[model samples]
Target: MQVNLRFFASLREALGAQRQLELPEGATVAQARQTLIDLGDPYASVLAADRAVRAALNQQVCEGGAILSHGDELAFFPPVTGG
Candidate 1:
């Protein structure tokens, strides 16, 4: 399956604004993240398992375990903080 990936904030700086990825059937958000991490370098550093990152599926906030579908839009960004 193919999905659209979007990176925001610092993640965008580290990775990029967008890219297309091919994942196996029934891939989850976590699996997608792992796939990028496996790329090493900036991808691994920015998306390290220990880092606090947030994900959205099709513009809605979702958990890492959330299942992904073909052509879905997946976004990754750091948590927002404001007062």
Candidate 2:
């Protein structure tokens, strides 16, 4: 299955604004992240399991366990804080 990926904030600076990704059927958000990390370098560092990252599915906040479907949009960004 193919899904759209959006990166925001620092993640955007690191991985670009957005890109299309191909994932196995039934892949979860966490798995998609892991796939990116598996590519090594910046991805492995930026999206590392030790780091804090937030995700959204189809513009709605979602958990790592969220199942992804074809044409779904997934976004990753650093936690936000406002004064």
lDDT of 1 at 49: 96
Q: Model 1 off-target regions past 4 Å?
A: none
lDDT of 2: 0.96
Error of 1 at 35 (Å): 0.4
lDDT agreement of model 1 with the native: 0.97
Q: What is the C-alpha RMSD of each candidate to the true structure, in Å?
A: 0.5, 0.7
lDDT of 2 by residue, 1-83 (tens): 99999999999999999999999999999999999999997899999999999999999999999999999999999999999
Candidate 2 colliding pairs: none
Error of 1 at 70 (Å): 0.5
